[model samples]
Target chain A: MKLTESLSFRNIKGRPVRTAVLIALTAIMAMSAICGSLAVMSLRNGLGALEARLGADIMTVPASAVSKQDFENIVLQGSKGYFYMDRSYYDKIAEREGIEKISYQLYLASASAGCCSVPLQIIGYDPDTDFTVSPWIRKSAGGELKELDVVVGNDLSVFVGETITFYGVTCNVKAKLDKTGNDLDTAVYTDIGTIKRLIAASLELGMNDFKDIDPDKVVSCVLIKVADGYSVDEVLNDLNLHVRRTKSFKTTDMISGVSESLAGVSGIIGILMAAVWVLVLVILFLAVYMSVNERKKEFAVLRVAGASRSRLAGIVMSETLIITITGAVIGIFLGLLMILPFNGLIEESTGLPFLLPDTLHIIICAFVALAASVIAGMLSSLGSAKRISRIDTGVILRGDN
Target chain B: MTITATGVCKDFIRQGKNTNKLTAVSPTDITIEAGKLYVLMGRSGSGKTTLLNMLAGLLTPSSGKVLCDGEDIYALDDEKLSRFRCEHIGVIPQGQTAVHSLNVLENICLSYMLYGSLKEREAAYPAARELMRKLGIAGLENEMPSALSGGELRRVAIARAMLRKPDVLFADEPTCDLDDENTALVLQTLKETAQSSTAVFVVTHERDAVGYADICLNMSGGSIGKQ
Candidate 1:
């Protein structure tokens, strides 16, 4: 018969349990593919963000900070605490032969005060000497920052033109950076004058750590760009040898470490997706095969009513396509429900970057996932369709009576 | 329309070391003419259903041809043969042929739907309703086959075969499990259908059906005997 929607619907509805099982299996397959793709895409975007944010070839932090919190916490986590070395280290690194550019930043954390909504990490850099954050600030703000103006991260609640008070020192938000899906999303960027004023205000507010700190003579970290024809390793070695009481790190090395950590998770999800698809394919094959076997007499009756073998095969394939397409749509919807609203929670629990693709890309991926499931269903039903096409109408009819 | 079978026979290969072949139906020649009811009466395993299946173009004969009108039905390939049968031949298979998922009306119009002649349910509903009424099943059109009585299901199958009004109609034990009244009703409908241009063939062991047939043949041990 013509493979109409009514025909497929009735066939599936006739065998409720079989249809339910097949749909469930196909849904699981689609769900696994969607969730897996989401995770892999997020990780890939997060890694890209991390690489772009770390514009420096090498970074030098106080040796004490490395001993206290290790490399990952200081660089990857965007730790709020700050430790500093003598400002003379900047001159020492600048004097090196292969140093193309060098900039130093002061890191400070706001006290938990009633004036602020949350304690935020504040990064203070010199606009004239900085190559890392200056280009972004210029692109976003279109001009240099005033003494008390600040650029906020995308995740912050404060908006441009709003004033945020840190330790009783208020600063105007000049611009907000886009989300990078990393620690930078929660940081604040400003000129050195703004952070020095905040530290002085913290001292006035009776903060003990700020009371003894000297913002003028101290530097938190130094970012260096290697000159052409000079490797990052050579610059790193030179900085380590010349700059006393500080440790130098290659940004590429830190990124490599982050990628290694992600490899394990990506591997697990890949295996899971593959396993689910294989299991779904086998279950669908068996379900269709058994369904066809049970309905041999029915097929014979249709043949007697003048249905060709190809028509019988079409019926079987149509039923499979209906189930698979329904299951795929449902699965994609469920995957979205699980992933979209709770992405922050996922990031927190996994300690990895979670960035969902844009709506267009997500829709494309969903369609591809759905098409894959339909193709899988068609392949699984091929054997059953062949069997139905080759059925002996007269033999089955005689046997049925 | 007339169905002519010439030197038709069927054999089954029994697999073993000896490879012996068993003949299911011996060589037989017969002609079933239009506007007449023909009944083949036989006990179980008498090859009555086999011969009926051959006449309906459902099986390929080992030797010889069964012609419908002027063309050998078997000479057509599978696709052409199926189309030809859909347009000109109808078979009401034995016992419980009703599809459980479809209502009586859907079952009645299944042949037209299968052959792509009827695309919409509305287009076939009138014909199906009329046939159901002729077979005394007018009210059961909306009821599922599972809810129908044994005789009602039989009538539904009969209505389905007759909906297309094929030139040849084959019914195999259509009245097997029906009560006497239902059986007589079914036989009378078959007789009325035979009075039209359609040729009717009924394979049954029911002695009562003999009274409704214009020509009756008795079958025993794979051979046909005129009675």
Candidate 2:
């Protein structure tokens, strides 16, 4: 038998309640660890995928009119906003020799009565010329997007065909687009003309502040794509000189910001996981220490009967290992449960653009938890074990006392 | 089979207000030999068990050496000394030290295994069964010590100690809780074990057990004089 099996069979078998408690404690710690790990890994992967797909390069906004402290924040802070694109800057970019084709797209967060309890985002574009749809968009309708006709993304399609009142006018879901497993999946693609009409109508209905949008003029942000020949710096400089109050940013910067935020979240998660381990170990140490103290005389008897201190220590350590291993296995299963439900949440929050964690991450995490638990058990038992194993039998067995 | 204890002193400092050092046991010199049944008789505070423990290698002397077969047991490192004790010495405590979780057969088997004679089962088990049968508690092999009567527990404890076939066997209060008839039976059991290559050391103040020993050494006032 392994040291663990023997120790458990001999020692733990005697105390049913204690053994159960130790296992439960270890399992709970492991579960917390797994939950923390899942959160970190998912958030990181999601943000990374977002950055990669969006080509997170540098961006330029209308240089802050505010002081240097808030200078960067002036244009950047309003994370999701729409401003008019200056036609004059577009003319300058075309006139520059090295500069290549320039395209622009508008954005909107659209919602309608749907199966989901939350509002969804809708993006409108001129499929033929929009820079954001320059290459990847494959129009499943066999022709370019038209006025009032919306090509529903995979996510939107579920609630798309059914009438969703947008600005009090019902629209049709012309066709369902392919899944991108990204923010695109949550978006509804239609002609820019339809969006402009919606903005005009909502304003007519007297809705002004966003949830109540003046649909007549509502365009949240404009996505501008620079051609391969012209560097982003050149375009940014030109736009800064020509357009006032209109922010010109490469798509890259926005995506990078999302990725950085995820990194910060992952760091916090890791710290929480570590704290759980330490807490669990402290609990284990107390339990084992008290139990060993109760059996002091028993250890004395064994020592007198010719058990070397090392052998006795081994027995004590083995008892802990056995308890920790049992608890860790249960904890891993619990940990997995903790991480599982959040898989869909991660996918939704990050737009499902990143790779889902496979069995490998789960298995590796479980093994690590088990190993840490066993080490914790050993550390917790150290003090009591020394006292018992090195018992001074001479004093205990003397009849004079 | 010679065991020697020389110039032994032991002091116990009880924890309390105005703490005092109480000298419990002080012995000059003593020797034990093969085939001898020695009895140590003492009053409640006479230090009889302390002397017995010193001889059994369970306790180290405050300032002296206990040599068994020319080697000071205390001088030996833990493993070597423990091995010597496991193989060469056997002790029967006052109450049942027979592990309660194990049945009779397992307890007897454990004694043989612990003393490093696991393969010598034919010599250990049959002897255990014959001893049990002679003690009149023959068929209680599977019964736990908690379930057994005082006499039965004592008999089983003796059976385990004797099964190891050690060079020396020490018993403390072997017949304290037994009637005359049972005492005689236990004494006979001791005599049979002593017939083999072993020395019998009994520590008790009981008159009946002391009367039957080959050597009776009376103890009083923290010293063993003569019988």
TM-score, candidate number 2: 0.73
Per-candidate DockQ values are: 0.54, 0.24
For model 2 chain A, give the 10-residue run with minimal summed lDDT: A71-80
> Can you tell me which runs of candidate 1 are displaced by over 4 Å?
A1-5, A67-74, A77-83, A86-91, A95-97, A111-113, A238-245, B14-20, B116-120, B134-138
TM-score of each: 0.92, 0.73
Taken in order, the candidates have interface RMSDs of 2.5, 3.8
Question: Model 1 over residues B15-103: C-alpha lDDT tens digits?
Answer: 67357887888999999999999999988988988899999999899998999887899999888999988889989888778667677
Residues A238-267 of candidate 1 have per-residue lDDT tens digits of: 778877788999988877877876787789
Candidate 1 A-chain TM?
0.92
Docking class of 1: medium
The best candidate in terms of lDDT = 1
lDDT for residue B223 in candidate 1, whole number 0-100: 87
The parts of candidate 2 lying over 4 Å away from their true place are A1-8, A56-220, A224-275, A346-358, A398-401, B16-20, B96-104, B111-140, B143-153, B177-181
Model 1 pairs in collision: none
